[model samples]
Target: MKRIGILSDTHGHWDEKLETFFASCDELWHAGDIGNIQTADTIARFKPLRAVYGNIDDFKVRSAYPKVLQFRCEEVDVLMTHIGGYPNRYEREALALIKAQKPKLFICGHSHILKVIYDKKYELLHINPGAAGRSGFHQVRTAVRLTIDGANMKDMEIYELPRS
Candidate 1:
């Protein structure tokens, strides 16, 4: 089993609580809008990171991470992008990618709204960890933690803090 921590839309801010919450996680996934390279570096130092460059990210961040990331973790096929939208309302590029790649898990961040929905049409789990940083219009900063065991994903948890 692999413990995973997921967050997005940091816009350059990092919370001290994040370190403690993700301490036991085997990997960290950043959906996008990471804000700056330092924030990315900090997370990378804490744990293995899989990330995509967000709209607000600078050249340095874009150079380090791709606009879209598709990979496998154990038995799960995962797809991540910064502005991929959600299920039926997916962006053109994201919809095309979803049709072509057919990932078991699809993750994206942009709206800074937390969502965890199962897409029946695509047979995939969709997650948006919301805005974990102090920037943005989000009322609450949120992050997600879950366990992936083979093809099963379980024990999902959400951590929320008032945006400071």
Candidate 2:
């Protein structure tokens, strides 16, 4: 089993609370809008980071991370992007990727609205960890933690902090 910490839209801000909250996680996944390279470096220093570049990310971040990330964690196939929509409202590129990749977990960040839902049509879990930075309209910054064991994902948890 691996404990995964997920967040997005940091917009170049890093909080100490985030470090503390994700201390026990085995890996970190960032959906996008990391803002700058330093923010990505900070998270990578903390743990292994799997990430995608967001619209606001600079050339450095985009050079380091892909626009779409697809890989397997344990026995689960996971796909991540920066601007992917959820369920029936998916972005055109994201919808096509989802259909082609058929991942068990689909992760994205952009709307800065926390959402966790099961897309019954695609048989996948969709997670948008919202915005973890202070630069957005989100009143409460959020992150997520979950345990991925074999082919099952469980023990999901959310971390919310007032935008500073």
Candidate 3:
């Protein structure tokens, strides 16, 4: 089993709430808008990171960060991108991209709303950890960490960042 830390839409800040629990994860995945390479470097200090670029990401950031991430963790293939916008908006582009690859876990950002919806029609699990710190509803800034064991995942932990 591999413990993974997932966060998204952190435009530029890493909230204090995440500091303590972060280093314990086996790996980290960012849905992007990370804001700077320094952020990536910081994350690297704790564990290897897999990241995707958000719409706000610049060319420089794209050069430094992964545009898309695909890998196997705990027997499941995972695919990640910056925005997994609803079909009503992008109309199948995101779905097409993900479907073509057939990853067990599909991660994305951009909406700033947290979602963990399963698509029975496709047998896919989609995750959107929402704004980790930099942007969101302002009601709360959230993040998720979980352990993947075979086809089953456990230890789903959520943290709400302290108000800034």
Q: How high is the lDDT of residue 39 in model 2?
A: 93
The candidate scoring highest on TM-score is 2
Q: Write the per-residue lDDT of candidate 3 for residues 44-123, one digit (tens) a residue.
A: 67678889888887787799877678888878888888877643343265778776888778888877777777766656
- Sort the predicted structures by TM-score, highest score first: 2, 1, 3
> How would you encode candidate 2's per-residue C-alpha lDDT over 47-152 as one tens digit per residue?
9999999999999999999999999999999999999998999999999999999999999999999999999999999999999999979999999999999999
- When 2 and 3 are scored with TM-score, the better candidate is 2
lDDT of 1 by residue, 1-164 (tens): 89999999989987679988898899999999999999999889889999999999999999999999999988999999999888789999999999999999999999999999999999999999999998878889999999999999999999999997
lDDT of the candidates, in the order given: 0.94, 0.96, 0.77
Cα RMSD, model 3: 2.0
Question: Model 1, which residues run further than 4 Å from truth?
Answer: none
From the highest lDDT down, the ranking of the candidates is 2, 1, 3
- For each of the candidates, the C-alpha root-mean-square deviation to the true structure, in angstroms, is 0.6, 0.5, 2.0
